[model samples]
Target chain A: MAAPVRNHVWVGTETGILKGINLVKKQAANYTDVSSVTRDQEVNAMCWGDPQESEILMGCKDGTVKVYSAEKSKFTEFHDCRGGEGVFRGLGVVDNAIITCVESGLLKVWQEGASDSLELQVGAGVQKMRHCDAHRQKVGTGGKENDLKIWDLQKPEEPIFRAKNLRNDWLDLRVPVWIRDLDFIPDSDKIVTCTSYHQIRVYDPSSPQRRPVLEAMYGEDPLTALSITPDGRSVVVGNSHGNIAVIDLRKGSVLCTLKGCAGSPRSIQCHKSMPLVASCGLDRFLRVHHLNDKELLHKVYLKSRLNSLLLTSRDKWEEEERVAPVDQDVKDEEDEVWDGMETVEEKTATKRQAVTREPDADGVVKVPSSKKQKKKKKVA
Target chain B: MPHIIYSAWGSTCPAARPPGSVNNSCKYSDAPAEGHGAPGPSLEQDVLLPPTFSVSEIKNKQRHHYMFLKLKQDRRREKLALKKKRKKERVALGDKAPPKPVPKTIENQREHDETTETDEFAPYFNKQTTPKILITTSDRPRGRTVKFTEQLSSIIPNSQVYYRRGLALKKIIPQCIARDFTDLIVLNEDRKVPNGLILSHLPDGPTAHFKMSNVRLRKEMKRKGKDPTEHQPEVILNNFTTRLGHSIGRMFASLVPHEPQFTGRQVATFHNQWDYIFFRFHRYLFKSEKRVGIQELGPRFTLKLRSLQKGTFDSKYGEYEWVHKRHEMDTSRRKFHL
Candidate 1:
């Protein structure tokens, strides 16, 4: 007998259970549970990975990020962003941290499981971060300030590198122009960030002072989401008007627009395994498309906007949301792995502002701020 | 306690790190508002907000139901429309002007045999003296293994006496390949075999071997048997010419009975159960290609015996049945609903 093809289609809907579709035989007779996500909470984003790892993760409208072990039909309560599962519209898996693009204008990250003894490694509140320009070796943090600060674990508080905002080269910093979506070119050192007012700027982070390599006009609407082929040849953008356009990066031209797709697409992901693309829209439609052939694979109707999705596969990554305060009382133990790690240096340095108060009865540390305040008052 | 947790991820690369967290420095933690207490006031303030928006939710529910109903209706309409279109195409095929409706040729339509109108079997000669002989092909023509032909022929001698009902392609293609094949071998004879069901498998070869095994509801016709009037089996085999170009699955051969006593039911049952073993052909059409065929009933054969095994499930058993197996033969076109 010939070998049967190994492929299955997993779909998430707003109501009922998730469905598994077998395309080879044109069969639509299988169903899985997304309710393990949240009872009546609209599934916002879904990412597929290995099935055995039960690594399928779903973000629901209830403000909860639920990581499900679909193989064993189990789920771990990952995080609650808003309240239940807040209005999550964007989801991306970069490097095991799940990157969520929410309506809060704040980017949040999550990881797999509980850390060793609840020693706080990192906190949330991820800001303007992009892996742009000649590919990102490190993450860039953007604030209301005029400079783009790039951070490395070796030095956490201060940026290892910074870029001045040419548009606002003044004494004071300007509020950022609301960056909406970013796409990293596969196997290259380039990233594209689509901002409000229909502007997609291609930047090479390695060259901080330079202008964008290629700037494309997206017309007059804000993009809700974007995706890039792993080869970095084509870019697909989904806009707020429920419009989806595929752009050939090499030619920098719009290849084509999908029709009969009615809704404002909030987020979209291009599947690497096949010529398929998935997008979520305000029309409550999660449409899977065949990118190369421009055929609609399937449209899963949801009750709310789809934010992110990961397909099925093997070892899974879950966003580590919360950890207890690190026990500062532990005696210096050489075997403690965190003592030798780079993040330890970075995390402690970021917490240095409070280090000024925590001396632990050792004169080795001194807080100078209180003395400075006393001298200023005496002068006044 | 020594902990050995087997962590698995849904990725092809088992050892690779998770996506999105390049630095793996995801800070920020949110835990359930630890009971009410805070700035002296607890974090449970969100609980005081109206539990879910009833009005907005009601409106959304109505809209969702509307769309669901609409989609269901659209699917139903699509299926009905496709079925109707297919039915129309099949029906149109039978009405096309057929080539040389043998019974309605200009000459045959003009000629009149008033004297033969008395007996249904009376036409050319006296039926009383000539005991009608039925011809049955021995399931082999040419190119067949001699042993096969002999084994089959030995089972019923006088092989040429049986009526055959198939076309030979390899021998007939050179004479007619471009012409639209329309002529069929029809025996308008009052043979000992019932006229209601005339079956044959002519021009036999090993490759042309087919087994007729199923039973069907056979229609029977009658004629006045007492008349000693002029009547005989009209031999339709004129020059024994093949009209079609080539055969893919349906071969060109004739089938009949060795003896003349075969009834209408027997002939129809054999015709219904007929099977020609061959390889199945798979065809696909390009989007840009123009198709000339309007309606088609293509039956492909298969030599892969494994394909003949029973399906993963049996409908009657209502569950998995792994033991009993069956061959996947053609002719079961309607056995499983599309």
Candidate 2:
């Protein structure tokens, strides 16, 4: 009965600490330590690796990264990614490897279970460098340098399968570029790659040169976050604005636009079996949304803004609950205690500050926040 | 709506490694480790569209939290009511409390003086060799298969399989020994049975999994006061497996221990990218002290197996990658590490 539960959302914050939102009881728990701390700079980008223990690996702003253990009620720093300059804003997780977007337009891949004794090994950057979505053979992710490059652990420098074609599209003829936010469709042969200026092009992994089986242009808005459904039927993209847009993958059209998020959603993630969509942004709210119904599932706002999110399943949470003091929800009841006071005014004012930094940069119109921020409102 | 929130406070399912179990990747994992030598470097970037992320891909996860919240509230409310009742009794009786609700009330309501419902002389005798015990035992599956037939055929002493069928009353065992068996199921369903075998109609995969060896079903005569074969369905017994450890359930009956398990053909069709799992299990005996484990069968052992044609039940079929998905009762037990 020691398995990890899918009950809470893990949050990577600016302070290099791992924060969590218990979906069950609605509470905020923090894991903070700096022994093998990844980054000391403002935690820029983060993506939670699959739950190894109670910890999730995170890429940071300081050209560094690290693994933070959520198992420790107190944050226990696990690893310090010393491999390369940390991720600028993007992170891709496969099995134990953390593929992050480094500043040099290069991808840094790191493995979990690495004996992170030193900070070098902890947030050790780019152990095996490779391309994203090489595993997802469906969609094409344009190429690097003049051709698509995939690094195989088989041969770290070279790709298992590189460019299937050597043709240029309209944009390539205009301005050549590198790929960002690349993902493969689950159980399919589709691959998705997002680039600067909100341009997302898809290619069949089997045939890289063929026209994208699906393509969507987000105009000038850069895709802030990207995630695929477990079934790979849909996709969600978040931008500078506090909005998340859902799109149908098969048809490649906008399904719905949700505007309730209070801050710029940095990263959005969906857990395996449990229906949970986690998003974190400058707003400091770790919000969990139900994917099936597109409803707010849970929110745990912390003192610092959230940059990345991860989670284990329900059963793992149950094990921790026994060791916990009380129900996490009971803690949420504190919301009522501060009603009708100066604290409320100060909170609203802080949100106003957050709103300035988070405007709708993507094509999605920001949804009204009056009712959308309910889960987050009760928290902070 | 009944919502179950995965509580941060709840416990995980009982887990065990079954000796050499490999922690499987999520079913939907792209780089499925299904016995892949190891993950290849994914840094090869051929630009394409990443799958679109949608809100529906993550909706209604609130049930997990609510489940935990409601459970705790229920427990808290119950505790308060118990305290209130104790206080009320203490105040009224001056420290001497009355007994609580009647114990085993269901037992008192179970008696019936009805006479034996059916006659033994009828073709479908309704009374047993002993007095009508009304014992409750679990039912064997109505779906019979080749494995069941083979097992049943073997369970019976081959020489004495049809003592009653041949009308040899002298060989009848007079006693109905209940100790050797955990449950006795007698199914008389309208199944597409073979010419003479009762288990002939069952699905091959599971019937083999059920360990029906040394079992037999035959038509017998009603003694002067015994023989309870009836035409009606009744649950004579129940012995549902309990969770002792992780996967204890599947070691005996679980064919998909952690397999999105690909048949070699499926693997080849998917170019071995579909992932593969070799199905294997250890058989079980009711009283065996050592639990049947999966490790001995071989963990992560890939059988370059191919897929069988659809709906083809060649009982002695060999298309499956692994035949050892099942174990026989006579399998020699060996020592292994957990």
Candidate 3:
């Protein structure tokens, strides 16, 4: 049960099972009871409940948002939100309230213990909705034929920034609008989106122009998921054909393509600080790639098709290894006792040797003995 | 002259030469060359000859062929003598002889895949629903493709064969679901030969697209049995052990009826070897308790999986569970996915 604290990634599978993967230990454990869950409860979207990331809000296909507390290693609560016709496209938490958006374009904010919740229709065919981490009241929604729109939760009457469709092509035919995934660029009002038409667009809400300021195309297949890098200089986007590439925001050129993805990637998320990105998809494997070296650091097969994944925001992974040994000490008292006895035996042996040689060389023995004591204290 | 003859004889019969003696001969040969007094003529001739000698180095065509034949015969004789000695030793030991070593194969040395759990085929094995398959060919399928599809429909019980007529698969899927079709099989033809097959399970799906080749219809197969009867044929799936393999095996299993009529004595086998699936139809007759005679029924072909999608046939939008990337997945000959 203590292993959940060290899990670096949480994956939601099509089989309705949530798995916590510990890359350091090379182990993955199912957090949900496999026997009790059905396919209808398949996890569609997942998000952190708070800035601390101690709780995970998982939106299931059956129109229920289940809150899982990482500290408790179990589900803390379940909220029913069944007004939409399709599965949830996004989930977010702001000020203890849960924000959920379904594919049918029904976006709702359920306040804590409230019977009547705030509901709004952003548009039909909502493919993705993302809540801005910097601005708690701001959320972005986009979908098939639905342009990118950022709405302020406080005033749900109208959208704050609505993206305009691109101009007609060379033949004067209208370009289709299908935004598969979007993310708000941290430290700014710019929203980066990847479309099913294999286009990546960056929208600036502060500017007067409603059209995207920058547009880039990666591959022939439709882009399914994208996550902005922590530095906000590049965005990692994966298409429906198992190809993942990092696109530079400034120049709109591909930086590098991450290899070893055999199926379409369903979800991709970059670490908050470290140059690491974790992605999982229909390939049934969660792969963590280093953003700089483009090296595959870890790959774990979760046995089922993964729908979404959430990577922990906690940095300093080496610090966790030091803390893990202390947790093990509480479980194995006999091993701790043996370790303590061995250290005491070594100390007494050194003291006896110093005493035996003290008479022959008093000043020299004292110098080495004092140094040994300091070294022993540091070891303890 | 004697040293030159000895070195040449040593090169001809490698087994006669003692270990580490090639260096010794080279050392001995170098001493005479440095001295250059008694055997000057022989030394000059030896220098012209190669240090290492083989039959292929012979200059005359007739002599080269004769020497090569003799060398091969010597090697074969030595191998046979060694085998005979081992057989004699084994016979002397009798019951105490060690067990024979198992031969290594690519399949035996294959890398173990982690995801080998097999619970996805529960519905098919449990016999919850009977198979109702709809078989169709590509638009304006040629004579050979039409014949292959017709034979495929006859092998599976309760299946209907329909003309494609340029109808879109996306549109036909919903109509098939409404009519309670459990599975849909589409044969794609190029140049009048069936080259592709798409098998999509109805309602909710796990569609599999395969590259099909080597089609042999009933008329083409020699000594073929009569056309397959309407009785349900038993399905036999071989070597489908991995997780992805199990899913494919289940897809094939769900295409036929649950129970087989023993009276028909027919069998449809999907045999997998090196990731290539060979489909065969056969009719058997039990002559006695010890003997059974089998006859081949028509329309045999091979299939190699291209991709397995999670949902129905939406190539542009569907998520693929496993896709065969030639450069990535096919790195090792010993590693197999199915």
Q: Quick one: best DockQ, which candidate? A: 3
Q: Write the per-residue lDDT of candidate 1 for residues A33-134, one digit (tens) a residue.
A: 432333356665666433232356566666766665543444544665552122555444444655554543344454455332111112123223443324
Candidate 3 C-alpha lDDT tens digits along B1-338: 43454566465455844456564455544444444564555655666544566666778787767666766776788789889999999999999999978999997788754343434445656666678899998899889988888889888888899999899999999999999888999999999989999999987888999999999999999999898888889999999988789889989988888889989999999999999999999999999999999999978999999999877899987877788989977999998889
Candidate 1 local lDDT, B117-142, one digit each (tens)? 22112221233222222233322333
Q: What local distance difference test score does each model get? A: 0.39, 0.40, 0.84
Q: Give all TM-scores, in the order shown.
A: 0.35, 0.37, 0.75
Q: What is the DockQ of candidate 2?
A: 0.00
Give candidate 3's error at residue B273 in angstroms.
1.1
Chain A TM-scores, one per candidate?
Answer: 0.58, 0.63, 0.85
Measured by lDDT, the strongest candidate is 3
Candidate 3 chain B lowest-lDDT run of ten: B112-121
Per-residue accuracy of model 3 over A259-368 as CA lDDT, tens digit each:
98988999999988677899999888899998888988888888888999999876534333333333434534644433665654454334334334333221211112
What's the true lDDT of residue B205 in model 3? 87
State the weakest 10-residue window (summed lDDT) of model 2 chain A.
A118-127
Candidate 3, residue A147: the lDDT equals 95
Question: How do these models rank on lDDT, best leading?
Answer: 3, 2, 1
